[model samples]
Target chain A: MLNFDSQGLMPAVIVDDETGTVLLVAFMNQEAYQLTRESGQTHFFSRSRNRIWHKGEQSGNVQDVRDMFVNCEENSLLIRVKQHGDAACHEGYQSCYYRRLLPDESYEIVAERIFDPEDVYGTE
Target chain B: MLNFDSQGLMPAVIVDDETGTVLLVAFMNQEAYQLTRESGQTHFFSRSRNRIWHKGEQSGNVQDVRDMFVNCEENSLLIRVKQHGDAACHEGYQSCYYRRLLPDESYEIVAERIFDPEDVYGTE
Candidate 1:
């Protein structure tokens, strides 16, 4: 029942299966979704790069698919996954959600970086 | 630093502030983002409706935003909110993600419906 928008993509929410933390939000095209369904791992469409990327393909911090859910309208997808390696974020944080916005319109760093992106991507 | 895509929108991940359960995924436009920041409540641009909506405005199941987070690329938003009523899904489930996908390629109902959608939307 899932439907893509005019851009041929839908939003996917990645959550930590054990901790319930929202790891990140990504997008998926039909191809990415099909591969993810078949492989039981996260795959995404990069909006900027205009290509499909297997999660952690370069950094090796993969997200192991645990379960998937779709909204009642089938407009969005939610996937609970076990994060492999130290982080799910390229910035080396366990989650892409590291900064918390305050009421004063400023931000506070709420999470610690688990790996250094420079260390992971530089050598790649 | 948030940037909308070519469609002038970005993905918003809605999560339970305390439980961290992903409740739903929505889209936000510039106007919606501004109103959300001003009101501390969830506002979304309905792509299908072609307008802005204050969540729970119709069903009385509002989402009181607790915090906001932006990704490293500032392309997506993570919103942690407290749901006011029993449901966030129009289907009357506490979470839009009530069905879990099994390896067999079938869906299993994993969460209980907290309210009846017909009741809430009726007599409106």
Candidate 2:
């Protein structure tokens, strides 16, 4: 069995299968892990929402799992997937990692927005 | 400022700069984050040890940071680095994620071992 932290969650790193681009990092509870394995789609445990998150449930940006790997410690997971939508980040970037940290500790926008968040999410 | 979790730690995904291979996923406390930023090397907070960890401190497998990116949520970080040694995993694989999950829920060794853990860690 895979190890879960004290919180019963394990961090999962999602990557683009072909491009090797890191898409998102999220946590997965046992239920989420089992669901992903059964459905071949990425599901995560949202820490804030305290529920199982079906990726793209809100944005239609679901990730189709291509492959999965478990770290040696069994405390984390690496998932390669085919991202269904142009954006994986809720902020509209292709990747969640869109801000490059500079030498001076400032951040620069390094990725172009693939979609307009306002158009998709309809303004919080 | 980057958002740390309630435990004052943030997850960081380390990647190979040239290959874009996901090398490791670790955590960083504020001190470890500052040390990594100052030294241009990967420093992590060892949850097991409850202290700041300098990657390669004992194994001599240091990762030289090439670039860093903060996720849109400002909670996680992606670090691209030049890996110094043949392996990043204590178990002697280039990556910690060396075991691929088979469809039947079994694991397969997908990556070749780069070193012997017993030789390096003196058989813990």
DockQ scores for all predicted structures? 0.79, 0.90
Per-prediction TM-score to the true structure, in the order listed:
0.95, 0.98
Candidate 2 residue spans exceeding 4 A from truth: none
User: What is residue B91's positional error in candidate 1, in angstroms?
Assistant: 0.7
Give a tens-digit lDDT track for model 2, residues A33-53: 999999989999998888999
- After superposition, candidate 1 runs with Cα above 4 Å error: none
Docking class of 2: high
lDDT of 2 at A26: 98
TM-score of chain B of each: 0.94, 0.97
lDDT by residue for model 1 (A1-124), tens: 6788888898899988888888889999999999998888999999889999999999877888988898887768899898998588898888887887677767788898888788889955
Q: What is the alpha-carbon lDDT for the whole of candidate 1?
A: 0.87
